[model samples]
Target: MKVDENNGTLAEARGLSGKKIKISKKGATPPPSVENKMSVGLIYVNEYYSGWKELCFRVLQSKFDSPERSFAPDQEIIEALKNCSIGQEMNLKQVQKLCMPFIRFKKDEAREVGTQALDLKLPFSEMDVLRENLELIRRQLGLEHVEVLSAFEVLSACDETAHAKAGENVKTAESESAVPW
Candidate 1:
């Protein structure tokens, strides 16, 4: 899957090595076959105080004018979100905090994501209807929480023990498959 920045067409194709791929709009394409489908993690900026909601919305609107920004997300959309600066005048820290337990699924549910990243609003009030509607969509779509990288997991995964354990698991699987059946 490759997202064209100039034209907003997402192309899906296999590479020379017969691996699925996703090329981001920003030209950063990670190795394919890492994951079956692309999973985008959302970072919700909770309102800090009174009027903070308005400010946060404004900051968001400056980048994404879509009413469905909260729901549907893609590569470019997530990148725009991370780069948004909040309360520049107030000297507040930017939204750099990444939350854990990302909203993900085992299978590809890209169609269930929100509308396209357009600047125009939908006919209905998406914000008002989102809370109730999103739950229904999730249940209907069978979305589930998948494992995402954590601080501890990231650190532990790089050690020699983790590598050895992975090797042992592969060997065990191979041995088990050797049974005549």
Candidate 2:
């Protein structure tokens, strides 16, 4: 994938089949201060649409751009937060709910709340906790300084490639199964 350095938008992606997909984000030009500090990537979650993911990206970006808001937490607190798990398969609404307190509360209070939330045993194993937290941090930080593409866009492209390959497989199978007249 490639980003447009001027605006932090995803300018292109090379799909598995060597097809190039270009994405254009509306009104995505970051201010001078944030321009050089930003990056872009893609995340795929099961069963969510691109539009929903796009909405989440927009909301997170708005929060980061708000003059009154600051997302910096104490490094120690951020390290502690590293143990917290934000589950996969979470939709935009679910993530918004999880992040609301962090957005509203003071840094220390938010850390405490996040610690408590992380303590709950939610059917995920200990190994998965680290992975989940990493994803959470990526989303949070990505909102502030990265442009995240919708997973559906990339996944759909791969799916299309898979279907085309499958069609070719079926044709080959049928021809092989037939007798040479």
Candidate 3:
């Protein structure tokens, strides 16, 4: 993936088929910011066509511009979440959901979350209704403060907020430390 932070564009990702696609920074859920590059981040892509809605979210690791792995929730995950109770303990798979939102592949190194080995592929494709629900899951988990702790933190939902606040503090400190001209 080629990342160009200079322009309004966010990043350019090459698909499995070698097609280069650029995700604009304009309408991004959380616009490109200094906080996005800290720790973890999420790049959500959504599209609506004739009678069809397609969207896919990629997990960003290290920096928002670099994506590791992409995932769309399968049907089983959706159903289980629909029946789940808020504050109810999430299973291993449910916990896995949190990691699904933020993985960056490292060459020659195996990436595993908890116990599940991650697939090191950028699986961006035409969106499906069920697949697109991945974003919803992230939001629900964060909003409800579901019991998945480590996984939730990896997903970057809550972490992003913390990072953003920290970024603000850094800026404040920088200005305060500036020497008068």
Poorest stretch of ten by lDDT in candidate 2: 9-18
How many clashes show up per model? 2, 0, 0
**lDDT on C-alpha atoms for all candidate structures:** 0.32, 0.34, 0.30
Q: Please write out the lDDT profile of model 3 over residues 1-181, one tens digit for every residue.
A: 1223212221121121112223456844443344332322233222211000001111222112223432323444344433444114456464345423322232112223411222223233323332344344334323222121222232343567543444434443334323111
lDDT of 2 by residue, 6-83 (tens): 123222221211122223478444343444433433322222212323232233333332343344433423332333
Candidate 2, clashing residue pairs? none
Model 3 residue 86 distance off true place after TM-score fit, in angstroms:
7.7
Candidate 2: where is the Cα deviation over 4 Å?
Answer: 1-49, 65-160, 164-181
The model with the greater TM-score, 1 or 2, is 2
User: What lDDT does model 3 reach?
Assistant: 0.30
TM-score of predicted structure 1: 0.17
Model 1: residues >4 Å from true position, as ranges?
1-36, 48-130, 135-181
> Each model's TM-score, in the order given?
0.17, 0.19, 0.16
The residue-by-residue lDDT of candidate 1 on 1-181, one tens digit each, is 1114212211111122224455778988776454554333111111111132333333334444244334334444345444444323233123323210111220122124333322133334433343334443333333342121222222245445533434434454335333221
RMSD of 1: 18.6
